[model samples]
Target chain A: MEKEICISELKRLSHLYDIEITVAKKAGRRWSYIVNAGEEKFLPSQIVDQFEGYALFVEGKDFDNEAVVNAFRKIIKKINAQKGG
Target chain B: MITESSWIKKVIKEEEYKKYMNGEKDFINDDEIMQKIEKNKNPDPSKIRNIMKKSLEIQTLSPDETASLLNVTNPLLWEEIYETAAKIKKKVYDNRVVTFAPLYCSNYCVNNCLYCGFRRDNKEEVRRRLTLEEVKRETGVLAGKIGHKRLIVVYGEHPLSDAKYIANTIQAIYSVKAKTKNGYGSIRRVNINAAPMSIEDLSMLKEIGIGTYQVFQETYHHETYKKVHPSGTLKSNYQWRLYSMHRAFEAGVDDVAIGALFGLYDWKFEVMGLLYHAIELEKRFGVGPHTVSFPRLTPAKNAPYVQKTKYKVSDENFKKLIAVIRLSIPYTGLIVTAREPARVRNEVLPMCTQTDASTRIGVGAYSLWGKEKEQKLNRQQFLIGDDRELDTVVRELSEMGYITSFCTAGYRCGRTGKNIMELLKSGKEGSFCKLNAILTFREWLDDFASEETKRAGEKIIKREMEEVKKSATRAYSPQVVEELENYYKRIKNGERDLYF
Candidate 1:
């Protein structure tokens, strides 16, 4: 997917889940993510991705367990598919 | 790509610039700043205490209040102000002092600033801009060898090293993850200290992961500004430089730093100018400067203006300025650089939050660090006072009850811009600072600390953990406390880059 489109999709998904995402670092295979302000989870580049930086952060206690993460992954997949990836 | 002659004209966009300014003028009012300084002289002790109380409440002081604190002449009252300032720093930032290395990437310039050694007119100064490969090489020594996690990457304002070059250099710094003991070291935060840029360039830098876009106004006084920055030069436009932070915010860059080179003007008036600048930022963006730097003018090679300036700030007044700035803008981070000698740094660091250690200001000096005992003044922007190694400085800070923090977790975790501003004012950020400081200090100690320094650092970590356990449920979550203990154990066992 185009970088801007992927970022917009991530923001949309984050807002849908009522989660906040802070962009950190660039896209790399060994990038990580944090969910609901808990432990850092290693992110597979194929599953979890971002445009600017790979470390997407979700703080506070508003989102469900792994739901926001799955939703974001789905968005990335759907957006990449829409662009014929 | 801009050509040489037209780049200066194209750098400042007139229509966008007008939006942030009041008609043709910038926010700083010289007459008002001087009048405030004059009127607030001989302030009563009770009034001074009241102003200090406002600062303790984390409220940004008014110009009158800041001026009153600056006019304080009574040594006993100055002592009280000093105590109050220290208390404010402890309240807002906790007792952790952040450490970073300054990488001066270039010495080329387009302006003839009279106070700077890198002025275009200086024929004796050696001018060079580091290549991307050289920048990575320099970062290797700073991060891999020295265990520094943050860098304030500096660049001179020439067409060759403009914003595009800055963005590229930052990427190079971040890409370097050199192997350290047990784990890797890389610069997570790259703050820029370059010339002012347009909104387009500033936004590009933000997209490329620039942290803390810093531009020092050098001197805020208009007449002095014109005298120093020669006419027909880009930096001669006082409004453009004054409103750099405004342009930064408008471009969506969250963390902008403001500063002044103090010796060029009256120290008291300069403090007032800094306060006004902070107030203007807060009024416009709902967030003030992320950090405020006041580097006293030291002698620079080929810059006769340094010795000729009559407004040189004495060591006593330098301490006073640090205290007053801390009291005036209680939430902002105060940077006391390696410009002052170790004696002066020790005296003033109680009121300051961040400082650089093992700092080398010459172009590509970090890679050539151990080969030379003394810095080449012609290649350096100014002489550095404290050239102690990072381990030695870290040990001293630990002995002083301060944990040398290598944490850039706040930027990564999104506690920036207005979010950081709110946390700092409410004193909630201190909790996060304490937690992260411990984790990152553990990382540094394991990776790069000397045997003697490691012992001192371990003592500090133990004391900090004890404090966390004591405070317990009030400041931290039960889950957080548990996780911190687990993380601490994991980091000690050779893990790296762990944070809450």
Candidate 2:
């Protein structure tokens, strides 16, 4: 089935700046490579950090400690970075 | 023997403006034009000779003749020309429309093609190449969004996104499950479209079950190609793009989608060249283009050279061009992309067109989500004309009398290369066609089509069977006749749809 980012609030907040990764295979139940972070760039990949994941960006710093809503801010920051901001 | 003079090119450029009239080429002034247009009538068959002659004689036309042909207002001629074309179509396709869609593996490109929004020079451009794991991820997402059983995996061939990478991705998409049809389908096959690659690259693609390889010439003329394409391997070798399909065929990829970016050429010459290419393929490999697409130029960033690529066919003429394709190849899958508006898209949905639900929905709808309140995209090549939902286009087509089919004839029947050629060229009707007609009628009636369309199809099929009987001399046993009669009668009587 077509998988969607489970986080609705994260989607709404980061929808503009963030990338909609094509969710690749999920490893270990949750960690999946959505899309290769730097695979698409014209420049070099090693210079900038990249995330290939089954996880959605959360507003919180730590998945263990913070609330889910805060992850939107965190996700948005990642998304903006992907945009080369 | 053919004229290769640059002056001939001038004739083409002049005629494009419709200033000079070639008496032999002008259909409007032809006496049959008025008779054919006489108020409310089925086309006169006597006009067929002239029309056929016209279609053949003006095989390649100057722009003026092309414009005149497109300007055909005679509804009778339109019906007759299209019907003949449909005959050609039926011969090859036999009531089947092959369906497939692009699974963009990566948006990354090395070229600064002047017309493409994906050009690296365009700073606003957002590019992404799905990694192997990411490729699999996109495949999963696409599998869910998948509408048709055949997949056409597309990617830009940057050095990073090489042949091996694409080959692996092809395998990846094929192996992934789409809501679990369990290999019965949900995307059974793949067709590849990317830059022209070596025979080795094509072999890898074929090994991965890549069915057709599509590479658009964009424009057949070389200098214009250089001008528009600007900086890339594409600009360096126009011949590579032209003969890519040919080379692909050599590398064991027989099914190929050959098309030109329509707005970029002298439309008539371009079309005739397409037919010529199909004819050439038939001569070479015993089959024509597996599919033909005519994607018009939609607005894109840094695409200022779009006008220089100018062979603008208006919406009306676009329909006329489509009709010509239906008449010309008649059998190949004629594809119309999301580059058109909703109204035009809906209006032209039936006349020789192929599309998938995914293309019209979820993500492929990227090009179509014009100025809406909220939209998401990596970035799009151009705007989309049709903004209708899948259900909406389905409804409208049914209402307007069309078979909204998702039938994948390629998967079930042994229909890809020579098998198809043999079936069509044998000049003998068989059980395959009979069963296809029955199944198609029933499927459309039950699901994708409207009540009125279903009725119209039944009526047309009944009339067509009588014609078929006359056309086919083979006689059948009494029991088989009874069975066939019962099948038709039961269907006509509004029986439940059944697959044979």
Candidate 3:
């Protein structure tokens, strides 16, 4: 299921994580968003193809990896609910 | 039609100009730019290496650093700078050259710039604006027959082709779904190269998904700008033109391109001016220009200034300036257009990221191509130096080991504005560039390329696939490789518009 996250929520989460969440066309069966999480804060990161549960897109030794992944999972759940509805 | 004077007055909004200014000043501090050039005249070899290193790190060079690069006189040092420029481009964009076609929509103007064939005073020239239907026709030839996925749609400044007309024309071009060899062809991106527009108009364009809003300051030298553009014209207001990108950003148009006409002033000064422009954009918006163009002076009908200009950039100086630009703003896409001859383009292509091919500059030249074999100078803004067909250019680029890409995926996927800047700086964008180049090249080769071009293109694709496979663990994750291989197979089976 895919949920449409509002732009404001997207911007808020982007600022909170210091990352960019680019809303892309719904490609193929999935992969609607291009979330970037680079080495340093605010650097656009690698392209993640799927947003499955707890899909960690972050890298480097700095951040709390589990915390970020958990947060992303919840966010994806909400978006998916919205999309499915 | 509105009278010329009122139209000019309406277009130059004082608020848009003043909003980006500091007190009474604009960003281009003329004296400071000149002084930087003067002080950095004899740049140390060590200092030059430091600047080049910063560029390799993908940092925007300080004005002083760019000025020092401009002053490097040693041929050996220049060679090193050229090589570094190529390295930086490869690091950021990979070995892909993105191609687009220039579609001039109109030639009517309110400003009588001395260097332009479309200037108001040139009565001998034929003026025409493409109606929406005509725009679609031209787009058909470009997207359907020529297989272009992008365009830099140009327009002269006049009420006839004002913001409303620009918006309608873009929509018309986008509406075209012309038949091709394999599938339907349509322009995925339409970048505008028109005069500076108001915030509201820019918003309208942004809302319509206009690709890049480009405005060349012509020359950043203040006095030269005023002289060439003439007093009492919309374009003469240098502050208005200078603050165009600021207004564009304010209006939510994040993808903006900036440029200067190099022959209007000293090449070194012009290079500094471009650097300053990039710096200002980066400072204010946290994102620099998506592309920088430096079109040197070319002959225009009845425009004697082209020949009379003392500051004309020679071919050697042109290459130097381009390399300097590449090194200075390593993250930005450097464009070297078809305005340059084939030899000059071939020489400079190593450092450039994007260029136009299969270009026709006349008001309605594309639709009128086969009917009129020879170029009619009166209908064109300027004569193009290269008129090679898209097939030849694509084949030649393949031979040079550089894949010709028709990827409009980045813009569509929102890899623009600050996101693009961050990606470019980190050298992460090249991964996307490599994958998209392969996919789009395959699409183009199958759909429209001649047998010769197809052969050349297929060989390059094989090499590129091998590289991707070799770099699987290094450059791309195994999962990403799996997806890429799937997409490649799908495209091979005639599915289209698939990208990473």
Candidate 4:
């Protein structure tokens, strides 16, 4: 089976990174995929649920200056955003 | 006349050269070998031949030379040694160490290793060999832990936990091709580290896509080996153990790892024997050890040697041996295990992993977690030298300017077997570079690497392209470089997916 970093992991990444942003992505995406909160080309798929192929990031200086934690926030916010949508 | 001729014991002169050439030999530390080599400014082959009647090159390196090679502080020498490793890495791998885990399918054994808790005679311990389903479950669990790209099924030698059971387990490991099967599609390889097998059993594993066949001699000295291994599979024929690599080679398993458990014999003699073994294998077959391991004896549940000081390896000395081994056999991969503490393992391991770009990994190391003691982790076989987490190791490698890689050119290409060695010996460096280039890119594109790791990999790629450019300067194709650039962009943007 394709074991992904589960969608629930975004919350964990969010909590760990200490940031607030909304995140959503295509479902079934490998959750270990770290989204650099800095890049523009990396974006969420238009199809909300099938978004396993894409992700959203909370743009901020945090993403660039400290990407490790920033990636966590982006991933969590993206996951949470998708759930809300 | 007999008594007069019997003056021969004195005439024998106890020559150091005699032992190495043909019989049971009197080996020396590096100090002695170098002393002899430097004694005469003018190395008169004829004169030395008149005194010793031996070829100058008829020898493996002495213990001190082995040690000196390990003490190799120069990056220039490291590059010289690692160049061959890099070339071989380019051929068999790229910048990758194919990760796997040891599924402790059975703890049963019939041998008394004197140093192992799982040895057969340890009646005080609860002995358990997992059933087929249990084995499957463990494999199922392990498949998820390391992301299932490969697995190394480990078991102690016992009658019940025999070849048939092992073969079945291999199938079960492979059968769980889906993550929902509580298995993973990630586990593409399974290497076995069990007892010496029959031709038939070895054949089964060969058919099973087992990546490599590995066995440690523990100690190459027969007397010491028997003394330590009083009552197990190891107690049998020492020759069988020595010749096992030959057997695996014959069975069509190209990748094999051989190691000596240090502190068992005079470390110097053991190193000489190891060199002999490696040289013999390469001379016998075009390919030698896919990897070599140096597992210093450490504490275990039933281990009795913790207090034994006679043969223990000093950290500085062991590191020396490791360095020399890297320099001596440039093409072969060297492995350092968690048997030592994190400090030692951390210091020595990078030499094999990054600077050397070694193909070695922890024997049953499930992840970078083996570097540290984590509650969720398995009870490792021995005390680990470094207990850093996997991500930490990746970060450290990157921080240290080494690439944390996931390249696996071996899987994508058919370089396994006589085919690979032939290409290597013939100096088909381009084919090798091509293979590693493909794998390094694939890894960067998929694995959850950090930015620093990502950057190191990028630098390595650029440096390697420049290397390829330098060698084939005018003749180099622009297409390969262009393709690499696109992959780099995709990786940077996180546009590619695993196996995409």
The prediction achieving the highest DockQ against the true structure is: 1
Which whole-number lDDT from 0 to 100 does residue B278 have in model 4? 75
Which of the numbered candidates is closest to the native, going by highest TM-score?
1
Give the per-residue lDDT of model 3 (tens digit) for B1-500: 57867777677789777967789988888999989999999889999999999999999999999999999999999999999999999999998999999999999988788898998999998989898999999999999999999999999999999889998999999999999988799999889999988899987787677888899998888888888888887888898888899999888788899999989989898888888999888988798999999998999998878989999888999999999999999999999999999999999999999998888898888997566646679989898999998999999999999999998876655576776788899888888888899999999999999999999999999998888878843357565667778888999899999875
Q: lDDT, candidate 2, residue B9? A: 28
| Candidate 3 Cα outliers beyond 4 Å, as residue runs | A1-21, A24-85, B472-474
Q: Candidate 2, residues B120-215: lDDT per residue as tens digits?
A: 677776777666776655565444433344566777646656788887777776676645222222445666778877676677666566656788
- The residue-by-residue lDDT of candidate 1 on B1-500, one tens digit each, is 66867877777666666777777777788999899999999999999999999999999999999999998899999999999999999899888999998999998998888999998889999999999999999999999998899999898888889888998899999999998988688888888899989888987887787878899999989999999999999999888888888888887677889999999999998898899999999998888999999999998887878989999999999999999999999999999999989999989988988989888899988888688758889998988899988999999999999999988876665567876787799887888888889999999999999999999999999999888878843356565667789989998898888775
| Candidate 3 root-mean-square deviation in Å | 5.9
Candidate 3 has what TM-score? Answer: 0.89
The TM-scores that each candidate's chain B achieves against the reference are 0.98, 0.70, 0.98, 0.71
Ranking by TM-score: 1, 3, 4, 2
**For each candidate, what TM-score against the reference?**
0.89, 0.62, 0.89, 0.62
**Interface DockQ per candidate:** 0.12, 0.01, 0.11, 0.01
Global lDDT of model 2? 0.51
lDDT of 4 by residue, B288-327 (tens): 7767778787766656754573988898778666655654
Q: Considering only N, C-alpha and C atoms within 3 Å, which residue pairs clash in candidate 3?
A: A2-A83, A3-A79, A3-A83
Structure candidate 1, residue pairs in collision: A25-A53
What is the alpha-carbon interface RMSD for each candidate? Answer: 8.1, 21.7, 8.1, 16.3
